[model samples]
Target: MNGIRKALRDGLVPPPPSAEPVKHRDAGVWTIPNLFTLLRFLLIIPAVISIFYIDERPWLPLTLVAVFSLTDWVDGFLARLLDQYSAIGAKFDPLADRLGLGLVVIALAWEGLLPWWAIVIIATVDLFLLFFILLMDAHQAMRVNWIGKFRTALTMVGVVAVLAGPAFAQPVLSTIGVLCVEVGAFLHIITGVQYARLAWLGRRRFR
Candidate 1:
C-alpha cells in the first residue's frame, strides 16, 4: 500500500510530505516521457484548429489524436524504463492528456460530430475532479483507479474515431470506432460514479 502511494506521488499525485524531492533535472532537460508529453501538447493546438481549417481532413485530426493517444503509453513506458519520473512530469503528463481530450471533445462538438450533452457530461465530471484536486492538499491527492484508466483509454480511442469521421468508406471500421467510444462513455459513467462516491465519503475531510 505504501509503495503504491509512493508511486502515485512520484507520478502525479503530487509529492507527499513523506517523499523526497527530485533534483538534477536540467541535464538534457528532456526525457522520453517529457518528450511524449510535449509532443502530445503540441498536437492539441493544431488538432483543434484543424476542425475549422479543413472540411475533408478528418483523417488528419484522427492521425493527430492517435499519435497523442500513444503519448500516454510511451510516457509511462519511458518513465518506467529510464527511472526518470518526477513530480512535475507526473502532473504535466496528465494535464497534457486532459487538455488533449478536452480539446478533442470540444472540437467534435463544435463540428457537430458528437452530441453536446456528452461533452457537457464529460466536462462536468472533469470539473468535479479538478475541483477536488484543487481543494485537496498533497496528502489527499486522489489516486487514479483502474476503472478510470480503462475509461481514459476508451475515451481517447473514441475521440480518434470521431475525428476520423463516418465517411471512411469502411463501414465496419467506423462502426467499431463508434462502439469503442460508446463503451468508453459507459466506463466513464461508472468511473465517474465511483469517484463521486469517494469524494462524498471524504467531503468533511476535504472541507
Candidate 2:
C-alpha cells in the first residue's frame, strides 16, 4: 500500500513525516511509456480532423479514439512494467490528458456527438485541479497522486463510451459514459481538496 502510494504521488500527495524524500528519477523522458503518451498527443490534430468526417468516415476518429484510450492504459502500464517512470511522464501525461480531452471534446461537440455542457464540465474540472496545484505548491513532491487515477480512468472510459455509443447505435452506452464523466467531475473536486489538505500539511511540517 505504501509503495503504491509513493509511486502515484505525481506532485499531489506529500510524504508522511520521517519518510525519505523521493529523489533521482530513474527513468528517461524518452521511455516507452512516455512515447505512448507522445503518440496520443501527436495524433490529436488528426483525430480532430477525422471528427469532421465522422458522417463520412466515423471509423477514422473512432479508431483514433480507441488508440488514444489504449495508450492511456499502455503508457501507465509500461511505466510500471518497464520501471521507466520519469518526472516528465508524471507531469506531462496528465497535461496531455487535459489538453487532448479539451480539444477532442470540443470537436465532438461541434460534430453534435456531445453537448456543450460536457465541454464546460471537463474544462471546469481541469481548472479546478490546476488551481489547487498552484495554490498549494504541489510540485515539490515527487510522487503522483493515486486518487487522480480513479478520476482519469473514469474519464477515459467515459470518453470512449460517449463516442462509441453513438457509432454503434447504443444510446445506453452514451448515457453511461456521460454519467461517468459527471461522476469524474465530482471526484476531481474531491481529490483536489485532498491534495490541498495533504500539501498544506506537508509544507507546514517541513517548514
Candidate 3:
C-alpha cells in the first residue's frame, strides 16, 4: 500500500536526473509524438479543401476526417509508448483536437447537416474551458474526466457516421449519425457544466 501510494504520488516513471542530459530533450518539440500532432494539423487543410471545394469528392474528405480523428488517439498512445511526452505536445494535442473538431462541426453546420445550436454550445464550452485553464494556470495538471473523454469519442463517431452516411446515400445511416450527434451533444453540455463547477471550486481554493 505504501509503495502504491508513493508510485501514484511520484508518477509511474521516474524523472530524469538533474545531472544527466536526456535524449531529444530540446523542450520536446521534435519528438515522434509531436510529429504525429503536426501531421494531424496538416490534415486539416486537405479536409477543409475536400469539404468546401471538392463537392464531387466526398470520399476524400471523409477519409481525411476519419484519419485525422483517429490520430488523436495515435499521438497520445505514441507519446506514452515512446516515452516522448513533452509539454508542447501535451498542449498541442488538445489544440489540434479542438481545431479538427471545430472544422468538422462548422462544415457540417454550414452544409445544413447539423444544427447551429450544436456548434454554438460546443464552441462556448471550449472557449470557457480555455479561459478557465488560463485563469487557473492548470495546463500542466489539467486532466480530462472520463465523461469528457467519452463525449469526445462519441462526437468523433457521430462525425464519421454522418460523413459516411451521405457519401453512401443511406438515409438510415444518416439518421443513426444524427442520433449519435444529439446524444454526444447532450453529454458535451453535461461535461461542460461539470467543468464549470470544477473551475469554480478551483477559484474558491485560491481565494
Candidate 4:
C-alpha cells in the first residue's frame, strides 16, 4: 500500500481528468458571443450590397467578406473563451453559416463572379447535409469533422481569392481561388455522403 501511494505521489500514473478545459454549452443566450453572432448577420446585408457595387468600389465586398469571416471566428472564440454557449446559439450559428454563405455564393453568381453550377452544387450539398443532421440529431454526432473544416477553409479562401484577384487584376489569384472553390465543392459532396452514412449508422445502432 505504501509503495502504491509512493507511485501516485511521484506522478507515475496519468491523470484521470480530461486535459481539455470545460465549456458550458448550456450557458445563457444573452451572452457576448451570441451578440457577435447577431452582428455577423447584420454584416451580411452590406456584403451582398457590396457585391452589386463591386465595379464602383472594388474593395468593399472584399473587406466586408474579410470582416464577415472574422466575425465567424470571433463568435466561436468568444463562445469558448467566455463559456457562453446557449441552445439558441448552438442552433443559430450553423444556420447563420449556411444562410450567410449561401447568400454570398448566390450573390456572387448573380454578379457573374461565380458559375451557376458552383451554386447548384453548394446549395444541393447544404440541403442534403441539413437533412442528414436532422435525421441524426438524436445520436449527438453534431461535431464537425476535419474534412468539413478543411472544406470551409478552402471555400472561404476561394471566395476571398476570387474577389481580390479580379479587383487587383491578378489572374493567377483568380485561377487559384476558382480552383479552391471547385475542390471545396467536390469535398462538400464527400462530406454529404459521410453525413448520410453517419445518420444511417446511428439509426441502425439505435435499432
Candidate 5:
C-alpha cells in the first residue's frame, strides 16, 4: 500500500483544474483567410439582383454561385495555410455554405428550373440533420464525413453545369450532374440518419 501510494504521488501532478484556454482568433476581417467568406456574402446581393432583374442571363448568377462554391474551397485552404483557425470561423463557415446552397436551390425551384421534389428532399434532409444536432448539442459536434464533403462538391458542380446548358445537349455532363445530385441526396439522408442514431445513443448513455 505504501509503495502504491508513493508511485501515484510521484506520477500525478496536483495542480488545480481549470477550463481550457479560450482562444480568441483574430477577427481576420481584413485578412485573406476571411476574404472568401466576404466574397460569398457579397455574391448573394448580386445573385439576388441578377435573378430578379435579368432573365436573359440566367447563367450569369450561376457563375456567381460557382464562384461562391469555389470560395468555400479557397477559404478553407487559406485558413489552413495561414493557420488562422477559430471557433467563430468554424461555426459560421458551414452556415455560409448552407446559405449559399439553400438560396440557390430555392431560387431555381421557384423559377421552375429545378424540380420541386429535389429541393424538398434536400431541405428535408437538412432539417432532420439540424434537429438531431440541436438535440445532441455539444455531444455531437457535426463533423462532415469524406462522403458528405465529396457529395457537396459534386452537387455544387452539378448545379453549375445544369445552369450552363440544355440537359439534352450535354448528354454526358447532364447524366453526371444528375448522378451527382442523386449521390448528394443519398449522402444527406445517410448523414442525417447517422446523426440521429448518435443522438439517440448519446441520450441513452447520458440518462
Candidate 6:
C-alpha cells in the first residue's frame, strides 16, 4: 500500500481526475421545440389545402390550424421546460408563425373573406421588418418582446376566428372574425413600428 501510495505521489500512475473540462451539451436546432416548429410548418400545407380546396370539409382544415397554433405555444413552453432553447429555434419559431399567418391571410384575401387593404398592411409591415432584420443580421440579436408576443397571439386568434366564420357559413361569426383580424392587424402595425425603432437603435449602437 505504501509502494502504491508512493507511485501515485510520484506520478507513476495516472491521476484519477482528468484535466479536461466536462462538455455539457447545449440544445441545438434538432430539439423537441424545433420538432414542434417543423410540425407547425407541415400543418400549413394541409391547412391551406383545406381552406382553398376542401370547401365542403372546413373542420378538417380548422382542426389542422388549431393544432398548428397550439403547437406554437407548446414548443415555446417546452423550450423553457427542457432548457432546449437555441438561436435557430428562436428564429425558426417566429418565422414559421409569420409564414403560417401570411398564408392564411393570403388565402382569406383570395377568398374575399378579408379585404385587400388589410393584406397590404400586414405584408408591408412584415416585409419591412424582414428587410431590417436581414440588413442588421439581427435574428439572434433582436429579442422578442412581450408586445410582439401578444400581437402574434392576437393575430392567431383573429385568423382562426375568420377562418371558422366562413367555414360555418355564419354571418355573425364572419363579422366577429373580421373585427378580430382588423384589431390584430392594427396591433401588428404598432408592434412593427416598435420593432423598427428597436432595429434603428440597435443599428446605431453597433455602428
**Which candidate ranks first by lDDT, i.e. highest?**
4
Candidate 5 local lDDT, 1-207, one digit each (tens): 665454444223322223322344554455675767777877876775655532577567667777888888777666655556654455456656666676776676676556677777878877665565556533233455555566678778876765554423454664565566666766767766765675677557657
Task: Sort the candidates on lDDT, descending order.
Answer: 4, 3, 6, 2, 1, 5
lDDT for predicted candidate 5 compared with the true structure: 0.62
Q: Global CA lDDT of candidate 4, please?
A: 0.74
For model 3, what is the C-alpha lDDT against the true structure? 0.72
lDDT of 6 at 87: 62
For model 2, the run of ten residues with the poorest summed lDDT: 135-144
**On a 0 to 1 TM-score scale, where does candidate 4 land against the true structure?**
0.77
Q: Higher TM-score: candidate 2 or 6?
A: 6
TM-score of each: 0.71, 0.73, 0.77, 0.77, 0.68, 0.78
lDDT of 6 by residue, 1-207 (tens): 664445333222222322332222457778998999999999887888777763678677668877888898788667656667776776667677777888878787887878878878888888877766655543343445666767777777777777777578766876776777787788889888987776677677768
Error of 5 at 37 (Å): 1.6
lDDT of 4 by residue, 5-95 (tens): 5433422232232333234457766989899889888988899889998888988999998787777767776665555677667666666
lDDT of each: 0.66, 0.70, 0.72, 0.74, 0.62, 0.71
> Poorest 10 consecutive residues of model 4 by lDDT?
12-21
Cα error of candidate 1 at position 195, Å: 4.6
Segments of candidate 4 deviating more than 4 angstroms: 1-25, 131-141, 196-207
How many clashing pairs per prediction, in order?
A: 0, 7, 0, 0, 0, 0
**Model 6 global lDDT (CA atoms, 0 to 1):** 0.71
In the range 10-95, model 1's lDDT, one tens digit per residue, is 44443443454354333243677788788888999987887664466756776777888887777866675566665456556656
Global Cα RMSD, each model: 6.5, 5.1, 7.5, 8.8, 12.0, 14.2
